[model samples]
Target chain A: MFEGGLDLSGAAVRVALPELQRLTNELLRASGLQVDHAAIVTDVFMRATYRGVSHHDIYELPGRLAALAAGKVNPNPNMTIINKYAALENYEGDNGLGELGGMFIMRRAEQLADEHGIGLCAIRNSNHILASTPYVETAAERGYIGYIVTRGAPTMGAPGRKEKVIGTSPMGYAVPTENDCHIMFDACLAYASNGVLAEKAEAGESVPAHWGLDSEGRPTGDPAAIAKGTRQPIGAHKGFGLTILGEIITGILADGQIIDEPQDGTGLVGMPSHTAICIKADGLLGARRFRRRTTELAERMEARASGLQLPGQRSARSRNEMIGAGAIELKEPLLARLNEWSAKLGVQPL
Target chain B: MFEGGLDLSGAAVRVALPELQRLTNELLRASGLQVDHAAIVTDVFMRATYRGVSHHDIYELPGRLAALAAGKVNPNPNMTIINKYAALENYEGDNGLGELGGMFIMRRAEQLADEHGIGLCAIRNSNHILASTPYVETAAERGYIGYIVTRGAPTMGAPGRKEKVIGTSPMGYAVPTENDCHIMFDACLAYASNGVLAEKAEAGESVPAHWGLDSEGRPTGDPAAIAKGTRQPIGAHKGFGLTILGEIITGILADGQIIDEPQDGTGLVGMPSHTAICIKADGLLGARRFRRRTTELAERMEARASGLQLPGQRSARSRNEMIGAGAIELKEPLLARLNEWSAKLGVQPL
Candidate 1:
């Protein structure tokens, strides 16, 4: 979110969020997506922007449109529930936009939870879901606990191994609190994502030592070497283990590709898969009690802070600070690019 | 298990595993447990030994017996299902041994998965469950993808705070493969467990600089300071986020204690709770195909590993190597203490 735009001195331009959202929706719709699907995908990207995580936001819009033009994504997908059970289901996405599929499956999972206390839905053949936090946060917003995992293209290597055999494999878990405040923990298993490393390399800056390895599998602080080689997991074997486990559940179990069979040319592997889980908080502990307890937990942790911060705390603060301002900061070049795309796609410019 | 025995000239003695198992069961039963419950507890501990993780093994047996003696643990518990849903259930453990409750819940979860393609069970008021790996592995062995989380005694601190607010909150996830092998990923969220840190401190060794903070929340390499202060999470805030999420689901959702409400020195906060999830892997991917794919993934990784090992690979190897050895290693002092306990409890010595 902090570092995804072209260099333009040290100043960031403020742009109205509504205008940006409208531009995103218009561009996607003009780029061959249905209006509803465009809205869904646009919302996901925009949510990242509002949360100051533009790294996963509309920054990827151009690439997504390129994928759509290349026929890698089906805008009008006839998604179907291929298998169903009391609390679990598997969906075939027909290679639709990942955000649409993710939203579709998450909503279904919540519905299943409403009927059965807990629900799980696995989706395959969905293009890259930009981020998982929003999907899980959606469940938390609906007063239920949510969990989601999406297998990305393989770029991470196994610990001590030269072979790249896993995706960043991001996962998210969220628990709801009162006032719509939820604790959402979303992270990729990799210590650093390829995008971040590439950005560092472009800036000619050194990365953290644990970020990745060189071609020889030796840890390096050189960003260029890391970008060319492979990203490492956060906790060595532990994170590697989690990444593989995620691939098994979200990819293999969904009848999607694993790292062994890499998809060529496509920025994303063939319609990467995802798993969404929803738990009825009220079903476990009465909703009121759970909310009160979460508030107490958060307050207690805040009081104990010696400098450490909770997840989403910074994002929430950033969102609150910008709400009244009516505009969000963006790299000038990115803003210009969005306008160019709007002109090229015959959509109204921001 | 690797090393939990008392010092014995830097070497351990091999004792017949059956003999150790018999001794453990005898002591637990003599201390007040029913024979079946004792066997369940002994099996969980012995499994850790077979996997070369003696750190969480029978070394805890004496203390468990002490808890029973002190009436801190209920030897004869009336465990019951307090709440039930289509694919979920809450069990009241009535202060029973955690292993017994874990096994019960895992089996129930598997059954639920059989009926609903997925199942989840939460248990409350159970004594310590040695490791979640064995419990989730139990599900994998039954041909289901599994997950388990157990809240331990609070000893971990969140980011920025000097107060210990969360337990290591160990969690495990496993997927079954062919050849009856499972990829089991079990880990505590902390950078290092207290046991490991204490071991390092005892050996007059410095731990990793980032392992934990001193009482004042300043980073330290002295394991003693870390043990006395607060332990840091692995991957910093990412691990902290996970530990908090685990507590929410496994602890708070089960009506158990959280960091904010630190229970008094009862060794464990009131009957620590756990959550177990089992997914019917065959429900998503056909049984044969899923098994074959898992086998292929493991084989591919093994072939490419340049010293990087897959999770559970070493454990499986250790287990196979010891199966026919007819004995297992233990620190001489620990073995002697166990013998003394056997005699003190009027049970036959190993």
Candidate 2:
């Protein structure tokens, strides 16, 4: 789920982080998101682009604005806690953008964990959250292990037949390191993402045989044909069960719309459901020792990997490179699309 | 990971549950485990057999006795809580049987969650805990969500080349239903377990190509060829990442031997590591509302599944059947061996 560098082959421009951040914030606010909520969304947006997951970056700005205009996303959601028992809290997101809801859940989970050693937050009525790395990293930065899983409308098919019964929900985990660093891994339950297969289709390339299947469950290299069929689960029933397992944790606990099917009329994806869990680092040893132990584990794992890549290795490396350069590379088409949306919202183009 | 029925073709006999349990308890006790600890082990052993996973039952009793005789397992472990931070505790397992460690973790986790809404326990110096279904069911029966993950020595390979870097690391979760019922899932990260493949090898059957690979990383149907090579991860790197993630939680947090490799001279698997987490079902709403919602979600998922089997459906079905009949089918060879061990232990044989 965490990969370095969008593989788009197109004209592109480098925009400094602060510059894009400014435009993103303005565009979000102009689209009617409250200023504070817009800033939260911008953090997730900017960090995802800077870390090379550009699919979740400014590329989606125009569609998000349209979603807001069509009332599929609430600009100023009345997020509320529906239930609270000890360290666990459940919330109603009021159909807010998932970026806003995700941040709120992560922060609240950390706060609860700080006091109780472990914490959880479940939210319903959310929309699509982009990449999960940033929200998990939020807790890792505070020396807590963070977990986030969110679901949208169904898009992944299960064992019996070719029909979407659950979303390809993304899940992420972060283990803390010293100096606000983290060892993070994130992934979807599908063997391959539709985006990757669609890109291959556009390039007239045969996709990996294991990535998709015909409606009869036979392996297929034709992305076009497979699109009408099913995306394979990572390892058949194991992956399929995990997808359902994640749904049970988030959608069931949140107890709003299941997101098992799309909503009516709007044809919009089902309102999403989300859950955040955090465990305090100091909850173990007397000091900040969990960080030291985790760093050591990561180091040993790196050596064990030998020629293999560690989880999140590429993403971590690219994140540092982008942060050092202080700029993000954006495809020209994507940049132009964002600029158009910004103009429509009466904001300065990037 | 959760498949129904041992596919082994062999002569077998039905043994009453109480009769088998008495012999199992005696064998364990004679092997040096304390009476209380032996009871815990027998509970897991009996439940696994009744639920159709017999590989982890009396089939392994002789080997477990051998390990204990070799000093690889502690007979009377002083399971110390090395650290307790609010609801989270870290333990030193004292190199005991993982069944003991796992039961302790699950029971303690439930007690902690009872007071704090959530709980966790991490233990080092454990051994194979067998299937996690029993432990997770402990919490689910108490109206909580239970999660358990444990690791042994490296067995599964990773991204770059064919070399074992982590264990298959069985993991499980359970959601509570009404009347002490549960919806549970348990799985290992590998594409297939070694037990299933080895059985196929003995039967002169060609294995599924995805289940194993030749040394050069090409898929192979030859079980012998794959035994020397690498077992494929469930979804390549995704499964690889998950194996290490389990290690980070249990091994790293518990602060003991890493189990990255086997221990010196014993030729035994690395001393295992374990972790358990639970969330109170009523932690969200009053009067066990979480159970109702979870049951609703399971019913919806059953409808969504249509013809596909649910995660633990077969196991649950077999468990109820066996409990109703008060007997478990035991392959004659396995039962004969168990009787031999019981005779040597001076207990009445079946």
Candidate 3:
């Protein structure tokens, strides 16, 4: 459950992108990430905001830093290759910053794809990566089709059971396009994302009956009940099946150790891992032809459903609007917390 | 929609697996597939039955053959590589047999995973590959996580609309496990597969209310009405989003052209190019460690679920029981069709 709605007007703060990046780097450095790792982590967090995925934005920094302080997460952890092949590498993250380690693996996948026309990288012992879209979109921007899957904290309904037994288990796919309208989709297998639940709790709003179940595994609209019970799968058994698949792909296929029991504080922080596959579209088809065909297909889809919008269009539009506004809108309390954290870190307030 | 059950017992026939394979190969050969291609195609079809997925069985073969004869599909079609990288290949199938082309690409993926720890192969201009589970299971058996996606004939409901606008876009994932209990899942994005609708129509049964809508895009339970309309997404918008994602991944990302106009039937006929990625678990951790950990995870899932069985367990058990019975049990009328088709093909009745 969230504390309450934050009043943003009084706590509003603004900083140039570069200035924000510097402060982020500094804070991460203080938390033990190296320069390069800190930069990458900061970029991902900020990019989430730029893309209007504010839930995965800097709001997560305090919790992550607290984890580092509590020794629940490793700082200055090593990420080394455990195995290498023509277009693939298995990385051991040494319980490192998930954002840093995930990006590292995805970057490696991109490099391999550059040479092989396709690349796949899997990492074990990594922490949580805030958002998965950025990794795939990074590959897409490079004219590659990116596919990514990751397992996270369990908060989803299981097959045949109303109880929560799995994480949101997000999956992402991004395809490059000629214009800025890259086709990208990122979603959790759960009917609603955990962030949505948090948002509802903060607003003291009741969720839809289908969002989750009570502690007894009965459907309920109470956000508090969902917090104590299970989040419903996006499409019942289909989504539950997908969550299981995502877990298998990230937990088992990534060669990461799978911990069944909830261990640390909240739950067993499963040794997270991810699989990133990148395909060079242009390599498969001439760039012009690929673009022309994709455009034609896009036009066809639009014609078929005049009202249908591609997955990422709204997010892209929101991003552009936010950029034009020159400042991100944040809840007041969250902004206050950010200011407080900044003050404590001896960094200039945004 | 279906005539009363035909006399299956009087029409029942049994043939050795090898004999069936031989006849299947000959049938394909007669239909213009090369010997090698016929073998692959035959294997795919037989595998469906072996797995107890009779819906995708040889009963569908005659329609396909007729389609081939009508030039709706090509026989002896050439599958050409449009582009290639070390671990990736983009292929154009020239509207060839989906089963043949799909298997070829999956085999390539497996080989690449073995060599490079990962591999991806995407093909366009392919037809249907019955039962996606087999393809992914094949990779899982080889100790890799397999992912498969394909777009089928449009049958799914779109968001905010009761009309059909998307394919039954199915997604499949498989993870290797011990005790032949590999975690595998495959399902169409729709609330029900189109085959389910066909079955309902055949039985003169009404579908569930949520299953679909009538031709006017209004919800209806009449099987005939649903057949003429569109199948609802598994969970409304969520499933709609997934279907869209699948289409983009396999149809667009693969650089296979998409048919925009519903009237053209090109979209329906456009060979589904599959993108398969295999990640070698042993590459991330040592083979022994990977196996042990996966076994532990599998045990935990089995134990945690209590009365619930894993996804593929039922199908596996059914297949074993059917095989042990020395003959597959079939509804009487289907058995008659098999007999009739066998007789026409000059295959001796068992």
Candidate 4:
């Protein structure tokens, strides 16, 4: 989804990270979200922004606040474990606090993996988790291989099908390396996420024909058509195949809501499903040996790759840069939208 | 790895299933492999041919036989489970039977999942497993989600790098469905396997520029150049990213030999590594509920996809048709090579 290196500096605003986090959290609480839930959302949003994933960052605040104001996101959730197997679990997310649910489930997975060799949990009835990286990174910090899969609102079509029937269904995977560098591969199954297409549209550029299809299932380069139509999968039918499996895991196995058809006019948010898996590197390979081999493998790959930038290198670099600067820059339109939400909720804007 | 479809019927020879299997098994045994080891190889080869994946079928028999003679593939191995955790294991293949190792470990995984909900094994020092399908299909038959990852000899260059640093590193996944059909996604990270390119070369056709590169790492449509050089990964760096993870799982975790650079003109088959994982569907969702939901989900996907065939549908169709015919077709050159090996070993040909 990393396309269109748009130069939006002229139409952008820089906000201190702490200040922005505080304001977003306050806005969510003002909009009737619980304090802990707002904190979780704000933390995830700020991290996404710092990593240059602004589409899922504070830009999503307005929609989330609206969902909360409408009582679609339950402020207080009675999260509980439902189906419990030795290393597998099914959790009821209670239609509330997706970030909380994601963190809680992943922590449980880590706990189980500490006891067992591997652990997995399928979660349902939650709102959007924003980004999947935090959950995975948390496991990586504990020297575990972490993975997250979640179904989102329907925005993509099956291969060669005219209608949309699948969510973005993003996947996140992380492996810890030496010296605190972690490798992560997080991406949506679509050729490009809707956010990337919208960015191209805003920049007045045509997308690649393979990105999405027109309303008639024909490939189109027009970003407007893509916005109106649906995304094409990453690798044609192969990617659609993966998306189908993701649906079975996140939707059916979790007993979660499946998006049978799109909700066009409804303003209410729909509950999505998620699954978290954690594999203990220490348990599989002794902790020290695993750590050494992990670094050695990454080094071997880089040495073989020569000039190629490895996966997650860019994100790590971006995060470091943003942290050093202590501020994150967002496009002006997104900043205006955040300001509008603040005003609507009668909260101070950053 | 689905790209150019070549018509190889002109260069093909049809052989009865029983005769071909017998000849192949005999050839392996004559090459110093044990009877059971030969049987495992023959069975996997037959399955690949039935599914129309002839590249990894009997076409690979000559290399395997040669590897056996040269002590690259051990005829008799003392396969051992080196490390065992609650539901995870690390196996040393002893440079022996990959198909056997795959089957034994998957059966172990099944047994583990039967008790603990999930089971996984990372295997090292094995020869090529030919194809990952049979192992995964075996798990699916027991109503489990099966996955396999393996590191092949380096055949593809990383993004922006000129050297071949990665393998086809295929990922195989399978899930059972109603009506005795199962969904299987088996594909390599490369745009196409070397076997497909070799087929194109044999048919005197040039490949697409996106398929592979020349020695200089420039994209070339010449199949010969690709056979001599490296392949371009599917979806550019994204596929390469996945390959790196596969390496970490199959190579580093299993402590298998990793291909650092291309070996030119060695004619030595490098031992590859594999990992198999199985998750019991019934453990997460009740057995009956999982079965019902699996079928319902497949039906829903088919309805939404319209005339677009699902991923594994083509292979299932080909297999059924081939089985009904009671014969499998091999390209004439491959068949000749198999017969030549048999004759050299003083074994009867089909």
Candidate 5:
């Protein structure tokens, strides 16, 4: 967040947590989402926003409600279980918001793991999953190791070309510990996320070199230059390879819709597929012992590596801080847009 | 392999596949490995070498035989299934050559998947498993989607630090396809593999910038500078996070010995752990339909992206070419070392 950040979004806007939640829940309900579906979406959005996962955070609230009202997203998806084979479950999504399907499948996977030591669930025809972190974190909280991967909108350039070749393919993994710092990891295969890039571009800022490539396939630091270009993948080919793997497991294995026609989709809202695998940490060594190992690893890493930031630490710290303050600060423009969307939805503004 | 090569390693030394296998199996047997153990090691080595996985390829054959003779590694290991749940199998290795444990555990995982639709296996106390590719490929060849991950010697630097903080943590994934061209992906979390970098260093070449950082934490193009430096991760923070995730799922989950004592021990041979997961592709839409989906995805990607390289294509192509020629090539120094080690083991020269 602080790569010599350029703050051109004017002043910060503070909104109380409870107020924002009310607005989100009501807005979603008014848009025709069932109560349970609305709650799922609201909880996911809140958690992501508090964790500073800006890409899938509060900004999407308005767009989601708009999508629901316009029938772009299914208001109430059945999420039927199309196939069940022992520890594996395959669900067919009814073009619903991905968070609902993600949560539903992860819960089912946890249940399957409870019965069979491990569970893998794949859900297809789901829309953009804002973030994969929350679903994996859901399992980790239950003292289970969690893994989730989803196909993303195509944005990252392939090995050498500057055109869109594959999805960002966000993947999340988490290890539960005795304590709350659960050693979570979540990131898109791309070098940078579109949310951060868009934020930077709006701020008239330059991005880090190699974050993306210009139209000519040269690494450029200008965020605005990404308009006609593609995001750079991490490790070049290695990251691209990971993206392919993610898609295969989710899109191919789940028999989901993939964005194949457009190599370069700007802010695309294609149906994505998600895969979740969970393992009960109590399988071999009990959860307590496994958690001890993770805690020790964290301590050992902290003691030796001065600048090594352990995963899940930042988000946990951020969530704690936001809870303590009872509020979250958003860019003024973002808050205004959210209020505008709420007004259109006939809901009280945050 | 052709990253603007600096070719100082003399001419290519070709070895007949059958001759290489005989020498490998015989030398391992003479050193103390049982027939099955020797065969496992030999097959894994041959497959890796044929696929041009230089790091875990034929180059390590001599060192492994020496390790067996010197008792650094158990020649014949009893890979005991320490624990088993309905769908999970936990094996404890006896310091055996990791290739032996890898094969045994993957086979067990495959069997478990047959029974439960999915299987997850974790093996602890294993030596360095050369390449994770063969194990995952093993699952793919059996019409199942497979994944394998292994802990590595600490080599990659953590974020904002040039010193060693985490292992390279290589992971491999493969999708079962109708044809031999499965979508396979195998890569360490690091930006560049240590093996490729070491080969470059021996060639007296300047490496790619950001492949590693010098002792002073500055990205250096000189491969020689890496001796006292650390390998850079794929994405600065994202890749480091993944490396941690990999170690946890394998090292921590398996309750194995990790290389925690030394952060910068070059060429350290520590007890690593491995985790394998297998999912029968026939769980949904049947294997034939699943294979068609993968084949279609591969074809679609190829049609659009001019330079985008699909995963598994390279290794499959290399293996095919090597098979067609009935031979594999190695650098002259590697072949000389192999023959020297074979002579010491009282085996015929290569």
Candidate 6:
């Protein structure tokens, strides 16, 4: 048993991945999500943390739970397939939890790709999904290439001008390689994500000048300034183009019209909607041949660019280290908050 | 004619879009591309110029023709569908002219999406395609959302470190909107495209500090130095990630595999293979309702962001002015070269 390097002598022991997933699912179910929905959400949340993305970890769960309890988010959403044709489907998420809705649609895409050479799914009326990588990574693990994008609340920069008109839209892509090394790339089109801004705020430090704007839409580094202003696009116009594309793909392309207001009638909260696509490699080339070629290509790329690292390499290494160390280091305050939430939920203290 | 103030008389006489397309098609056909292939290539070329994308305009025709004469690209390729599923297809382009092959596959995707809700097509063994936006814009014009991505010849910046490892992969997305305004966004992940670098080199101008690196992988503003180094990715690591994702989506995901070696036979020439997708709004929502809602949503977004311009608005405006002016401006040397080429082909001088 790996002790998580925490003071667990008088508290309940930390659980393994599977155990944590189960407990998380139970908690979500108790809060009103269906069993399958809860499981999917739990899987995404746990995997994000397990993969070393602490910013997307369960630290935000209490706030989300509170939102759910207050009916700010739908608990028993009527997510249903609104349209389907051979390798394509469209799902109406009915303002459901985005993690669950996103996973379900991606899985459907995978299944369709398995039967056909390719599959695509677009979903509307969904809430925020913690991380975007897992959806594409899931398809990559199944020997398929995956693409996904989502539009969140308007938190990023506008186009040529400097005001906030779009969200920090996130996009993800994953492809299978040889030896279980799947190359995954995921990112938001903003110069800085809200998480980074939040961290800067907590640290009482200023952000990079290029990260955002000050009041009146001029560039600034003060975190407080960002609250009143907006984040900048990564490469000025280029990142703005990407954000627009993301919104079109997830918002308009998915047949989920890019509305200025939230689907829940709460005004423009910019709740995310998504588009997911899967392409089966085996369908294009025989499975063995595809695998071998992928391995060869990866090897050649690594050999040619001797110093460069492929996408996902760092995350994979971090995950391995966390596992080997049998512990994940967490900020003291965050851990305290987690324990407090656990106590309030009548769950065993971590 | 409007005779707009912008200088464009350096280019050949302006003709109607269709006439220009027809003339281009005739020229390409005379150079050896099949009739259908020539038509599609010409369509893209003409449309690019029509949209004020002079960087990817007909100015490239001479070089493309030279490449064809040198046997660097095939004009009469036996393009074939290598794999097919309900909503997806994999194409073997047989190392053909990329413009033709790319359009063929994207058209196939549009067809499938018309039947299904969405369709995806991946192609391998292709050459350069002038611009990606045309493919997606075509889909948008047909009432479908479109996505296209492709890997280019190696030219990428490293993360944190400054060096070349990948290509300035480009991605494009388009959606149909009301008021004949199709939102289109296309961009390369690099801070500066090679075209811009070449322009700076020609003008003997210093590039922006953030544009690229020096020969020894150090930051520099000298275009010559950057040519010896590599272009920077936008937003550092995040842009690097997007470039990686684009490579996988078009290369490995499409079964072409990432080409790593700088001197590898496969990496020496033009753009690599690509992936294209089309999602039919009518398939996702009923035709009438989908159209109505999309129009409403677009209006709403425009109303909410009252001061912001939508994607492609500036380009469209520029195109209108250029068209009304009856001529397209061109650099003196470029015009001289085009005349030279026209003379060699026994065509009347502009």
Model with the higher lDDT, candidate 4 or 5: 5
lDDT of 1 at B60: 72
- At residue B337, candidate 5 shows an lDDT of 72
| Model 6: CA > 4 A from native | A1-23, A201-208, A253-259, A264-268, A325-327, A331-336, B1-23, B200-207, B261-271, B287-307, B322-335
Listed per candidate, the RMSD to the true structure in angstroms reads 2.9, 3.4, 3.8, 4.0, 4.1, 5.0
| Model 5: per-residue Cα lDDT over A1-350, one tens digit each | 22212243568877899988898899888888899889998888888887965547776766676678788789889889888888988898888888898888888889989998999899988877777778888899997889999885566788767778678888888888778778888889887776677777878999766778888878788887875588878887789878887887788667775547332233344468899989988887787788888888777677767756888999999988999999988777667766787788788887
Best by DockQ: 5
DockQ preference between candidates 2 and 5, better one: 5
lDDT of 3 by residue, A15-116 (tens): 556666676777777777788878888888776667765566666777777677678788888788877767767777788888887788888888888887
TM-score of 2: 0.93
Q: List the residue pairs that clash in candidate 2.
A: none
Q: lDDT per residue, candidate 4, B128-163, as tens digits?
A: 787777788778888898888888677688764568
lDDT of 2 by residue, B79-198 (tens): 998888888888888888888999999999888898889998888777778788889887787777899988777777775356776777688888777544466778888877877677
Model 5 Cα lDDT, one tens digit per residue, B17-108: 99999998988888888988889888988888878755567777766766777787888778787777788878888778888988887888
lDDT of 6 by residue, A24-56 (tens): 676677678887778788878776676776565
Estimate how well candidate 1 is docked, as a DockQ score. 0.59
Interface RMSD of 6: 2.8
Report how far residue B190 has shifted in candidate 6, in Å: 0.7
CA-RMSD of model 5: 4.1
Q: Which has the greatest lDDT?
A: 5
User: What local distance difference test score does each model get?
Assistant: 0.78, 0.77, 0.70, 0.76, 0.79, 0.71
The per-prediction i-RMS, to one decimal, reads: 2.1, 1.8, 2.6, 1.9, 1.5, 2.8
Docking class of 2: medium
Candidate 6 chain B: worst-modelled 10 consecutive residues by lDDT? B1-10
Q: After superposition, how far is residue A299 of candidate 6 from its true place, in Å?
A: 3.2
